[model samples]
Target: MKALVIGGGIAGLLAARVLTETCDDVVVLERDKLSDVPEPRAGVPQGRHVHGLLVRGGEIMEGLFPGLYDELVQAGAHLMDAGEMRILNPLGWVASTRTGLPLLVVSRPLLETHLRRRLTAKIVDDVHVTGLSFRGSTVDGVLTRNGRVDADLVVDASGRSSKLPSWLAEAGITVPEPDVVDSRTGYATRLYTAPPDFPVVIAESLSAPDTPRGGIVMRIEGDRLMVTAQGAGGDHPSREPEGFQEFLDSLRGPIAEMLTDAEPLTPVYLFARTASRRLAFEQTPGWPGGLVAVGDAVCVFNPVYGQGMTVAAMGALLFRRHQDFSAKGCRDFQRKVAKIAQGAWALSSNADQSWASEHHAPGPLKRAFGWYMKKWQVALTHDQDMFARFVRVVHLVDSPAALMNPVVFRRLAKYSRQDPRRGRRRAGSNPR
Candidate 1:
C-alpha cells in the first residue's frame, strides 16, 4: 500500500512514520524546501518561538521511534525535571520538588529536523498539495502542483493553515463548521545566550482577571535561552525591544529580572492571533474513506499551554492504534482523535476564554466548578500532592476529572477557609 502525507512538519513526519508500519511506500509532501539543519521555515510560524515535549508526548514519540529521546538529548536537547522548572500559575508558584516528570526542552526546528531525518518515508519538499482526487465517495489520492500522487491512504498532517477543508469540498465532501475559540492573544519571543545555572522561569499572569500577561524563559538547544512575553485580549507584546522589555517586566514573576543581563541572539519575533481551533471532521456526514487528519490540522491549542506538540504526538499514537485506514474507518478514527484532543482542548480553551471579552457566562454548574477551581489553585500552593496531580493533567498524562476526586475536594475545602491572600504571599516569597 502507498500513503501520502501532506506537510512535512512534526505531525506529518509522525503520521508518515506510523503509516510506514502498514504501507510499503509513504511519501510526505511539504510545500517549503526544508532546511538541512535546525532552522526556521515559513510553514511553521510558531517555530521561531519556544517548544517543549511533555512527558506523555515524549513517551509516545519514543514508542513510535525508539532511541528518539536519547538522540535528542545527545543533540543538546535539555532533559530536565519538569518540577524543577520555576513555574508561576494563576493560583501561585507551583511547588518546586522532583515530580518524576521528564521535560524535553528543544527548539521546534531541531525536533522537526530530527523527526524528518528518522522517518523512513520519502519526503518530497516544495510540493504544494492543492486538492484531493476522489473515486465515488472515497478519496483515492492527493492532487499537487506537480501532479496527482495516487495513494491508498492520504493523511493531512498540515498545520493550522491547512487547505483540507477546501480540498475536501472540491471532492464533494462538506465538513461541519469548526468550533473556534479565539483568545486574541499575542506574544513576542527572542533568543538569548543562557547564563550559567539558569533555571527555566515561567511567570504566568492568567491569575488576574483584569490583566492577562505572562512570560517564559527557558533554555533551548545551542545553549540559548528563548524568552517569550505573552499578552491576552488586546494587550499584545510589542515587537520593539523597549516595549517587549516592558511586557516582560509586567509578568508576575522573576522573568524580567532573569533577563536583565542576558545577551540576545535574535530580534523579538512576534506571533499574534493565537487561537484555539478544532475542525469537526468526525461530524461530517458521508466522510470519505482512505483519508485522515491529525495534529494541528485537527485541533490547534494556544502555544502558552505547550500542548501543541504533545497533542499532535497523541494524535499520531491514535493513528498507530487504529487498524483500519479505509474510508470505513476514517470516521471512527477521526472521532477517536477528537476524543483524545478533548482534554487538551478544554484546558486550553477554558483558559483562553477567561481572557476573551465576549465569552459566554458560565452557568451555575460551571460557576460552581470555577469557584472550586479557584480554591484548588490556592490549595496547589500549599499542597504538593494536588500540585502533582495538576501537573499530570496539564501534561495530558491524566484526566482533569482527577481534580474532582473526593480527597481533592476535601483538601480544597480545608484550604478555602484559610486566607487565600496568605497563599499568594508564600508563592510571591519563593525566589527560586
Candidate 2:
C-alpha cells in the first residue's frame, strides 16, 4: 500500500511516520522547502510564538518515536516541572507545588525539525496540492500543481487554511456545516535574552463579558526568553516595541516589569488569526473512503490553549492503533479522530465564546459548565489536589469527565460557599 500525506508540518510528519509502519511506501508533500536549521518559515506563521508540549503529548510523541523526548531535552528544550512555573489562574495565583507533570518547552520549528529528521518516509517539498483525485466514491490520490500523486490512501494534514472542503465539493460531496468559535484574540511575541535563573511566568485573565488579556514569559532553547502578550475582543497587542510593552503592562500581572531589563533579541511579531473551528467530517453522509483529515484540517483550537500539537499527536497515535486502510476502516477512523478532538474542542471553544461576538451565545449547559469551571479555578487557588487534576485534564491525560467526578463536585460545592469578595481580594492581592 502507498499513502500520500499532505503538509509536512508536525501532523503530516507524524502521519507519514505512522503510515511507514503499515504501508510499503509513504510520501509527504510539503509546500514549503523546510530549513535544515530550526527557524521560522512561511508555512507556520505561529512558529515564532511560544509553543509547548503538554505532558500527554510529549508522552505520546515519545512512544511513537523512541528517544524523541530525550533528544528534545539534549537539544536544549526545557523540561519544566508544572509546579516550578508560576501561573495566575482566573481567581488568583496558584501556589507552587511539584505535580510531577512535565512540560516540554520548545519552538514549533525545533520540534518539527526533529520529527522530520526522525521520519523514514520520502518528503517532497515545494509541491502545492491543488485538489483530490477521486475514483467513484473513493479517493485514489491527490492532484498537485506539478502532477498527480496516486496512492491507495490520502491524508490531509494541512493546517487551518486547508481547501479540502472546496475540493470535496468539486468531487460532488457535500460536507457538514463547520462549527466555528471565534475568539477575536491576537498575540504579540518578542524574543529576549534572559538570565539563566529566570523563571517561567504566565498570567491569564479569563474572558468574561468584558475584554480578556494575558501574557506569558518562558525560557526557550538557545538561551532565549519568549514573551507573548495576548488580547481578545479587539484589544490586540501591537507590533511596535513601545506598544508591545504597553500591552504587557495592561495585562493583570507584573509581566511588563519582569521584562524591564531583559535584552531584546527580536522585534515584536503579531498574530491575529485565532479562532476555534471544527469540521464534522464524520457526520458527512456518503463520505469518500481512502481519505482522512487530521490536525488543523479537521479542528483548530485557539492557540492559547496550547492543545494543537498535542491533539495532532493524539490523532497520529489513533491512526497507529487502528492500522486499517480500507474504506470502511477509514470512515471509522475519521469518526474516532472526531471523538479524540471533542475534549480539546470544548476546552478551547467554550473559553473563546466568553468574549467573541461572532460565536453563538452559550446555552444553559455551556453556561453551567463555564460557571462550574470558574468555581473550579477558584477552588484551584486553595487546593493543590484540584490544581493537579485540572492540569491533567488540560494536558489531555484525563477526560473532561474527570472534572465532574463526585469528589471534585463535592469540593467545588464546598468551595462555592466561600465569600466571593474574599476570592476577588485574594486574586487582586498577588499581581505577580
TM-score of each: 0.96, 0.96
lDDT of 2 by residue, 1-432 (tens): 899999999889988888888889999999999788999989898989877678888888888889987898799787877655677765667655678988787788889999999999999999999999988888999999988989989999998889999999998888898998887889999999886567754555545655388877878778888998888877789999999988877766666766778899998999988888899888777788889999999999888888998899889877667877666777788899999999989888887787677657679999898888778767877787888888889899999999987899898898899864466434334433
Worst 10 residues of 1 by lDDT: 423-432
lDDT of 2 at 165: 90
- In TM-score terms, candidate 1 sits at 0.96
Off by over 4 Å in 1: 426-430
Tens-digit lDDT track of model 1 for 1-432: 888899899888888888888778999999999887999999999889877678888888888889988998899887877666677766567666678988787888888898988888999998888899988887899888888889888999988999888888876778888888778888899998888877754556454365577777778778889898888887888999989888877776777777767898888999975888999999987889989999999998888788888888888877567878667799999999899899889877866776666788877876776677778778777777877888788888888898888888788889989886777643334456
Question: Can you tell me which runs of candidate 2 are displaced by over 4 Å?
Answer: 359-361, 424-432
